[model samples]
Target: MKFAIISVTEQGHKLAKNLLEYLENDPSVIKVDVYHKNVNSTLNKCFEEYDCWVGIMASGIMVRSVCPLIKTKFTDPAVLVIGENGKHVISLLSGHMGGANHFAVKLAGMIGAVPVITTATDLAGKMGLDTLAYQYWLELDHRISIKNINQNIAAGGKVDLYLPTKFDFLKNHPIVNTSYKIDIWNKTFIQASFSGDEIVLTPRRMVAGVGSKKGVTEEQVFFALRSALQHLHLPLSRLDAIATADIKEDEEGIKLAAIKSDLPLMIKSLEEIRNFQHPDCTTSQLVKREFGVGGVSEPAALIEAGDNSRLILKKTAYNGVTVAVAVAI
Candidate 1:
C-alpha cells in the first residue's frame, strides 16, 4: 500500500525520512513518499492519493488539518499521528477498514515507539466487524448499521452471525457468538435475506477466468464476461477477480476490460495452470497444441480461486472469448 509521511519541523522532517526508509524496507509497503514543506497544501492535494497518511507533528495539528477532509470510515484513508520525538504512534482515524490501527502498531514496532490504538474493539480484546470484513476482504453494504453492530461486539454483547458453509472458519473468530447457531446462506449470495440489526459479511470469492483470442477489443472481453455471469445469475459486482494465463498478460483487451470493470486482473503462470488438475475442467485440444495446457479458463479459475474451489460455471464459448467462473472455498 502507498504511504505519505508529512513532517513540519526540521526534527519532524528527519524523523519522517527515517520512518520512510524503514517503511520502504518492509516488503508489504509498496511505496513511501515524504513531504516536509507546505504541509497543509500537500495534505489537501495528496490526501486521496495515498492509502495512509502519517503526520510527524502534534496530534492537534494533524487532527485539525484532516477534520474537513474526513468523510466516512469506509472511504477515508488511514491517518496516523506521531510526535516529532517519535515517542508514540496513534491511530487517529479510519482505524478499522483503512487499517490505521494495524499500520500504527507496525510503525511503532519499527521505530521503538508506543502504539496507541483507541478503537473500542482493540481495547476490549475483540475484533470489530469492520476490521473483520476488511481483513477477510468481505463486502459490507454502506447502508448497514455497522456502527451499532460493532458497538455490540465491543461491549461484550452478542451479535448473530450468518455465513456460507465454505466460510465456517469465521465461527471460531473471536467476535463470533458461539452460543448462537450460525445461520447458513445456502445460495451464493447472503445479502438477499438479512435483517438490518444483524451483522452480515458478504464474501467476495468468485473468480472469473477468461481466455481470449489475440487482438480482441475490450468490448468483446466485457461481452463474454457479462454473458458468462448472466448465465449463472450473478452480477459483475459479485466477481472478485478476472484470471488469465501469464502468457496472455500482455493482452491489452483483457487488462483494459478488468480495469474498466473495476476488477483485479489475476494472472497465473502457465506452469501453474498446466499442473493444476481438476476433474471437471474441459480439455481443449487446440489449447493443448498451442499453450501445452489442457484448458485455459476452467483451470485458471480454480487455480486462482483456491485449492478446494469448484467450478460454478464451466467453460462457455462466446464471440472470441471463453469464460469460466469459480467460487473460492
Candidate 2:
C-alpha cells in the first residue's frame, strides 16, 4: 500500500512531517510518499500513482483535486484529510469500499486525533460489505452491487453476509450480531446472488496442477483446466495458482495458459513431486518413464497447496492436457 501526503501550507508541512514519522513506524510496511505541492506539481498525478492520499490542506482542496478523478469505489484510492493542528482526521472520499475510513481511524489513533467517518454503516455500527470483503482479501465481483447494498443499508435495509463455508473466525465475530446478518451455507457450489445487494466472496483457496504434451496449444490447456474446475464445482476465482513440474516450466503452452489466466505458475522439482503422496492420482506409464514418477499433476498440486495440503481432486485428462486440484487444510 502506498500513502501520499499532500501539504500546502507551512503548518500543514509540519503536520505532514509529524504524521510521516508515525506512518514510517507502521509495521504494515506500507510505502508512503509526502508531496508538498509546488507550482508545477500535479495532484491528478498523485491519484493514479498512490493507493491512498493524505491531505493536510483544506477539505475543499482535497475534494476539488479528487472530484474529476473519482471513478468507482474499487478504482479510487483512499483519501484522508487531517487538520493542520492534527486535531481531526476526516475520511474524505472512497471511505468504506476504498478503505479510507479504516485508514482514518488508524491514523487518528496514532496521532491522537478524533476520526470523522461520515459513512452511514460506520456510524450505525453495521459492517460495510466492502470493508468485510477487504478484511478477508476477497475481490469484489462488482462494486456497484456493494454501493447499492450500502445505500439500502443506509435506508434501514438489512443485508446478509453469507459464508458458504463455516469459517470459525466469522462464527465468533461480534459483527454477526450487528445489523448485518451472517449465514453459513457449509456446502460446495454455492451460487452468489448479485441482486438484493447480496455479495459473494470466495477464499481463493485452491491450487491447480497442470501437465500437457510438449506441443499442446494454450487454448487446449485452458479448456482442459476449465473442464476440470467445472467438474469440481469450482471457479477460477477460487484458484490461487497453477502448478507444474519443473521440466514443463519453459513450455510455451503452459506459460501462455498461466499468463492468460493471470495466475502465478509454480514449478516443483522432480524430487519434490516424488516425495509428495497422493493416493487417488492417475498412474501414467509415459510420465513414469520420463520423470520416474507415477504422475506430475497431482504431486505438483499437492506440493504447491502448501503445508498440510491435501488433494481434493485426482488427475483428469482431456486432449493431452492433465489437471489436478489440491486444497490447503
Best by TM-score: 1
Lowest-lDDT window of 10 residues in candidate 2?
188-197
lDDT of 2 by residue, 125-236 (tens): 7776777665444556655676777665666666665665534346566653464555667653222343444455656357899988888889998898888877544456
Q: Clashing pairs in model 2?
A: none
Q: Report clashes for each candidate as comma-separated counts.
A: 0, 0
TM-score of 1: 0.61
Off by over 4 Å in 2: 155-157, 187-198, 204-329
Whole-model Cα lDDT of every candidate shown, in order: 0.80, 0.74
lDDT per residue as tens, model 1, 1-329: 57899999999999998998998765345468999868778989989988799999998989889998988899899999999999999999999999899889889998999999999877888776777666555667643687776676677765566666555555655445422335666754333222345444578588989998898889999998988877554457667789999988999999999998889999999999988887668689999999999888888889888878867677888888999888764
lDDT of 1: 0.80
